[model samples]
Target: MKQLISYAVAALSLVATQAAAAPVTYYIQSEPYETVSNFTACPLGGCTVKYAKSNRISGSITLVAPLGSNLTDEDIDLQIHSFSISDGQNTYTDAQFFVDVFAQSARVSTDSAGNLTSFEFKFDKTHGTPYGEASYADSKAKVSYIWISSAPSPGAAVAASNSTCQFRGDNVNGNTNGAGCMMAYDTDSQGASSASTTGVTMSLTPPPAPTPVPTLSEWAMILLGVLLTGAAALNLHRRRQTA
Candidate 1:
């Protein structure tokens, strides 16, 4: 009977550990977008140019991995949760854009200890932007907007003239055509704001660890109760024997 009880307790503990080790989702949130000030732009003829502006951008992405997985060695799926860009005069939300087809190469790099080091990806506004690219190499990440559109709504299809590329790291087999490095800057058609050449700091937040099922203390309490109940039954048996 004691052996059976021991086996049951061990099984429960193993189950708990396995449950706690299950994969988890993590969130990487972009700090509030910086406002690009003293910005200037010229139209086609270069005669009239817009001057001075401010803009704000915000968004977050999600990645998944085992609770203790080494992110540096993991090729995780990337999902963009929310994004927005504003020109101080006009604002746009993620609904107005889509992750480029090459987004599959979007990746995160981390130290061997699982600390994030850098991340990179490209996305385009729905109307006609070739690509909005960002790469993290140092303490800050730099972002560049190839082009932007004036579409006021989200979920709109990419314009026929729109072009984009996959990250160069994703251009497997030394193929460079249509790779991210080929992307070129273009004049914004609708005056959508562009991020400054300076870097934008981003923060990554991991999901809280799952609460262990039947914590060690709780298991001890459960074991104590079972032992007490068994003792009580044994005492009752002794009383009946005496009777």
Candidate 2:
């Protein structure tokens, strides 16, 4: 009985030791999308969202994952920290744009088996203008922006002649939740805005599962102990029967 208990403890110890550590992988899935499928608001509560309801608009989202693909706080910070957006005219850049940029959003992707494989990140307005000394703002104001068809309303927008920067803020009336704004700079667009660059998509994926190996030294030791304990128990039982 004592031998059986000892072997059991040994086996548990081996598993615990092996389970202590795991390697994490990092990689960028794709360029950040201008708009996700059902997302039209800033999911990460505090980020400022600009609501634009323009019929025709055009812009480009340039997202860079400075770190690998961990998406940790540092990764997120770096992602936002190294971001730049342009409509061939106005541009924005701010390091503190990561303000309140959190994860827990409904923007996620799934595998063919219907499993949650990865999730889309959230963004907030980083700055208002080029010389804006202030960097970030709190998540307090739940301002409901209204986008109308024919007219432009009171909202933070970077407008241009043949081009329009409507993607800077989220269209709350449209129920969109993506506002990753950092710094701001405006340029003159020579051509009109197109629908082509409006839907840039990007996602962060998780590392694959670790594979099993038959020659694992630690696992081998655990197996050996179990085999020996069973043999000893059997041998003791035989001796008692003979006695």
Candidate 3:
């Protein structure tokens, strides 16, 4: 009987472990858009006064890992198990976006001392057009990219020495894409332009509220019921033996 009870408890333990859910979250707060620089220059195509802008967006980007998977701080490139964005009003899921943002593009960077330097999240939709090829798209398929770093500061020219500023996830082959983490939300034929920013803050999302545990009295009641059932079974076994 003791052995049987032990086996049953072990089975319950296995089931609980299998049914458990583990998720990781990252919190992102964006800075307002601002002008980075302005200069008068004549390009090869035409003459114009050009300026650069940093990335700034108003929304919450939530990233979740796959079930049964373990994600650690040391993991350089992370899989985009689940992705969503909430723009203070509506939330958009991965299905709404034309591109699969999870193809090993999400990454975290650290310094030599293993201190977190910065991290970036890249996702965009070009209305079925191959990413990077779509200069413009509809609202549902608009292209969007977000990058938040620690160095060079927002609205400042990207530091050449700041190697961690690169966004090489989905777009590989040394594509210098998503520079300065500039965000664009334009839905016109002219295409969206990157925006400048004052600064952005990032941190680990707080853990969800913990489930309440049973009180000692409740646990005692459960234990008493189990003991009674076991005792009844033992008593029946003894009677059978006597007969």
Candidate 4:
């Protein structure tokens, strides 16, 4: 009996330990578009400037992973992978205006099973800046790209604009025809760590376990009764043989 009780205690301890180390889940959300300004050199000599305009192009992306996984919040970098802009009619591509935004570490909470009960991604946009210039034309430029673990080096011709001329930049400078505007990439890239951002913390609580129909105590009592009966029978047979 003493041995059986010790084994049960050991088993329960193991179960508790496994429960505390379960897997966790996390979610990601991104907002890509923000306002930016473009400058142009005057047709004759002086520098021409177009005040930054508000580009309403924005989108979101979500990713999931276990709690304390190999992936870090810093790995959640967002680059203007690709994009295109439109002026209510025609659309153009802005391939060179790629930028990298760094994401802040995530705030994570887990349950007994080590599963991620909740998570939030916070990012800083100040790290991002324009990479290359576009041609001076009057068409909407659209660009697209990916958000990955690290920043990528500049590449060859990203995409083409509607310009009849093969201009390297996305034709951002309005030509004599007054057609210079950029459809830049907008996204959120955040890093993760053990700390929390915004000075505000978030928490996740696991749902309560369902009640058992008969209860554990009742089952335990029934098992004890069966064991006692078997023990009594064995003792009676031993006494009869001795007599």
Per-prediction TM-score: 0.38, 0.23, 0.41, 0.22
For residue 80, model 1's alpha carbon misses the true position, in angstroms, by: 7.5
Task: Candidate 1: give the clashing pairs.
Answer: 95-154
lDDT, candidate 1, 1-243, per-residue tens? 999999999999999887655544334222223333222332322212122323222234433333233544233333334444332333334454333322322445566566655544433322223323332211111122322211221111111112122232333322212323334232344222333223332355543444568989999999999999999999999999999
**Model 4 poorest ten-residue lDDT run:** 188-197
- Global fold similarity of model 1 (TM-score): 0.38
Error of 4 at 42 (Å): 24
Best by TM-score: 3
lDDT of each: 0.37, 0.31, 0.40, 0.30
Q: Rank candidates, TM-score, best first.
A: 3, 1, 2, 4
Candidate 1 residue spans exceeding 4 A from truth: 1-55, 66-105, 126-182, 189-192, 197-243
True lDDT of residue 8, candidate 3: 100
Model 2 alpha-carbon miss at residue 9, Å: 5.0
Q: For candidate 4, what is the TM-score? A: 0.22
Candidate 2 per-residue lDDT, tens place, 149-192, comes to: 11111111222222212334432222223442222212112122
Worst 10 residues of 3 by lDDT: 157-166
